[model samples]
Target: MNKPPRKKNPTFGIAVFIVVAVLLVIATLFYNAIKEKREFDSQNPDTQSISSDAASTAAAKPASGAAQ
Candidate 1:
């Protein structure tokens, strides 16, 4: 009696490799974004206060440059 040969799925391996690469890229981007945001926030601890002060100053000033 003769035996039949088994078939292999080559696409499965390629698909798995693609998925893993995509996941790694996404994770790297997420990590970098979080790190940058943390660094920015730390450097500007009083962001809210500075923004509020700027808003108040702008509001107090005249919108036009004409003399009173």
Candidate 2:
């Protein structure tokens, strides 16, 4: 009697592992970015004021004055 060959099924474990690893790396980067932003914001509390001041100064200048 001839024996039948067994069918082989492909494993998705490696693909799953790779996907999880990529997700973990992305999450780590996102967390680090947030942490760095928080630290920078804390260290430079006057950033908003400086930006507002610059905006006010720019608004005070007339754009058409230079052309006239």
Candidate 3:
């Protein structure tokens, strides 16, 4: 009696490789974006102070105008 050969599924392996490659690409992009944001924040510090300054100026303007 002759025995039949088994077939392997190449598509499954290819799909898994593609998924892993895509995930790696996405993770790299996210890491770069976070790094850029940190660098930007460090270079331009006082972002948080701008909002407080604006609020204080707004409050002062109303009082000063009402006094005049």
Candidate 4:
């Protein structure tokens, strides 16, 4: 027999593991950001108030700007 025994390559497995690990890390960060955003929105009522104030000002701005 002249053929040498074949050795298994680990590069593909290692690459797959790294890819999955990176995906998990990215998912975790995305989930944490979403959780934080939800918490912020739930805790802050001022944003809603500010939006309402802006709406009022927006309505007044056009009228105030249109002078005779």
Top-lDDT candidate index:
1
Q: Residue 51, candidate 1: how far off, in angstroms?
A: 11
Tens-place lDDT per residue, model 1, 1-68, is 78788787999999999999999999999999999999999999877776899999999998797688
lDDT of 3 by residue, 22-41 (tens): 99999999999999999999
Tell me the lDDT of model 2 at 16.
Answer: 84
TM-scores of all candidate predictions against the true structure? 0.61, 0.58, 0.61, 0.61
RMSD of each candidate relative to the true structure: 6.1, 5.1, 6.0, 4.2
Q: On lDDT, who's better, 3 or 4?
A: 3
Candidate 4 residues 2-60, lDDT tens each? 99988988998999999999999999999999999999988985676668888988887
Residue range 1-68, candidate 2, lDDT tens digits: 99899776556777888999999999999999999999999999877766889999999998975875
- Where does candidate 2 stray beyond 4 Å? 1-10, 49-68
Residue-pair clashes, model 2: 0
Model 1 TM-score, all chains together:
0.61
Model 4 TM-score, all chains together = 0.61
Flag the better candidate by lDDT, 1 or 3: 1
State, as a TM-score between 0 and 1, how close model 3 is to the true structure.
Answer: 0.61
In candidate 4, position 2 carries an lDDT of 90
